[model samples]
Target: MAPIELKELKDQLQELLERGFIRLSVSPWGAQVLFVKKKDGSMRLCIDYRELNKITIRNCYPLPRIDDLFDQLQGAMHFFKIDLRSGYNQLRVKEQDISKTAFRTRYGHYEFLVMPFGLTNAPAEKLYAKFSMCEFWLSSVAFLGHIVSAEGITMDPAKVEAITKWPRMTSVTEVRSFLGLAGYYRRFVKVSHVWPYP
Candidate 1:
């Protein structure tokens, strides 16, 4: 907290670097130095960054329209849903924008290998690209009853096949928990379809 103590800490950090106990990831915003370990696996130094995230640009992206999604599902009997793994992380920030993504943790300040959730332009740009890709896939397979919310409802095997082809969705869960208006039409699904039959 004192100026002399701070100077001493920095000098110690420099000594650690000189002794091969850390590595640095250079960015235009600031330099992030990381601690390294020796073959014995003991921590050899400390890293810290409380100054970076404060200056990083904040992110804002519009949420996709839900009604537009429902419109895509006009007619279908079965539905399969897909969710992306670390979807935001799948995108790469512009090289110049990387420094803006730096965050300080107890260990050290680190930039993301992919776009992080905290950036001003990240959400809009990333979502736009993702939705645009979905729209393109929908348009290309117009006959598959319109992708309808990155989730789809259709009895068509072709639609199931298409949904399965998506990058992350490998298995389709087929236990119906809610039937909506269609429940009234089925006279026998074992009991009053309005309530749990079991």
Candidate 2:
């Protein structure tokens, strides 16, 4: 689908503001827009930019090296993970690329007021900076024990073992491999007396 014009996008933003679905905030990076619900109880305008991200250039930022990560974990045996809430939304995209990042949805097309995922340079320019800054701060501030970067909270072995014991769970590797070979050669291999099918 084609992108919406700037005029139309602004109109949509205005309507959302009028309806009290969003509030505007100013930041050093740029305009930071946030979603707010109306008193009557309705959702605010939110943009989804998955498609635009496909065409944008990805920022080239080097992640922590494996050796560095391992070194940090040397004395740690247990780990817990936490995900930042709306991490990308905290960033602001460059002014020049804002139009290119406009998105369409059922209600209307709208541009992001803050940085979003799937945009080119979003990872390196915004995400990396925020994450690296946090990492730096954590490293500089000493803690009782090491806290490794993880995507989710750590669970005890008993909880994990209970999940493995779920009913109907079965191994299918042998069955899948056998069926794969049979299907692959079905045209050449036939059931016959000479074939001695098993």
Candidate 3:
């Protein structure tokens, strides 16, 4: 880590500890921690839980599908987006399972007393809770990479711009990847039964 990132990491660790989200642990299980750069040039701490997730039993609670969410938004006059801060940290981890969330840092080994991101069950756990702070939109609101409004759902402009500016494909793999991304908005586009190649 860079000197700045290291300092940020230490600060974040202290903050998390003070907030009662994590505590020092002596668990045999430990994951690695790293910092990712946020869009606004801040470091966001993340833990690599791939090893833990591999052995863990997954909770297959089905989350609301995007199409289903959009269907419910139809004819709405206003919209509000709730952006949760430390959303996962708001949920407590079971006493016995706390050690499973342990991660080691140069500072020390710590385990989350609350849930953390990157866990296989985090999404399912989210369904049980709600958070504070909201942004209200009278006309439209950007949600899950799409815009919802009284006019109905449309692809978010930023995402559409990104798709338009996507790099030229150089291989079959790249072409498939691009198609996979673009295909998400296929519902908004017109399609023809006749094949252009055939």
Candidate 4:
């Protein structure tokens, strides 16, 4: 990891520790944490649970589609998007399953007391809990990259412009990363802005 990212991780972990989001643990299963840069220029820590997810049973519950979610807001004059900071931290992992979510960092081994990002079923499990009583409401506040408002959804010009400045993708990973951001806001801008979607 870059020095800056390592610093960010340390800071994040410190806050999590203070809030009891995680606890030191020794477990048979452990995943390494991965970090990504957010558009806000912040680091988001994720556990690479790919291997674990492969063996875990998938949740049958499906999250409502974002487009469908948006449709529900039509003709509505009000919209309130609550930004939940460390929102997942508010969710408690079942005691028995907490061990399964254990992760190791250079600093120490820890397991989440709350939901951690990257679990395949996490979105499904927390969808209703996070959004309940909150439709026209949202879980994470940022939908498809645009911040929702009572005035309705609108894209930030800086973000729309940044998409134009990204270099051409050279790999599948790069393509996924680009699409994950651009695809969510495709209707906000021209499809051509993020061409060659796979």
In model 3, residue pairs whose N, Cα or C atoms come closer than 3 Å (at least 3 residues apart or on different chains), thus clashing, are: none
- Cα lDDT, model 3, residue 75: 89
lDDT of 4 by residue, 3-92 (tens): 877888899889989988898989988899878878698778889998989999998877788778777765565556544545566678
lDDT for 77 (candidate 1): 46
Number of the predicted model whose lDDT against the real structure is largest: 3
The models' CA-based lDDT, in order, is 0.44, 0.45, 0.84, 0.76
Best by TM-score: 3
Looking at candidate 3, what is the lDDT of residue 66?
82
Instruction: List, residue by residue over 1-198, the lDDT tens digit for candidate 3.
Output: 888878998999999999999999999989999998887898889999999999989877777998898888888998877667667877889999999999999899999999898998775335332344566665788787898888888899998998899997788888777777777788877882433220
Model 2, range 1-198, lDDT digits (tens) per residue?
A: 224334454665687457443344332222222344555674343444445556556657767864466467655544543345455666665666555555544344445556655454555333333343243323222222212333322233443344445344245764455455434334333552243233
Structural similarity to truth (TM-score) of each candidate: 0.32, 0.38, 0.83, 0.66
State the lDDT of candidate 1 residue by residue for 44-158, as single tens digits: 3232333554565555555556455556555544444333544565676666655555543333444554654434444533333333323332312333233333344333445
RMSD of 3: 3.3
**Candidate 4 off by > 4 Å:** 123-142, 145-198
Q: How close is candidate 4 to the true structure, as a TM-score?
A: 0.66
Error of 2 at 169 (Å): 5.7
Per-model root-mean-square deviation over C-alphas: 15.2, 14.1, 3.3, 5.7
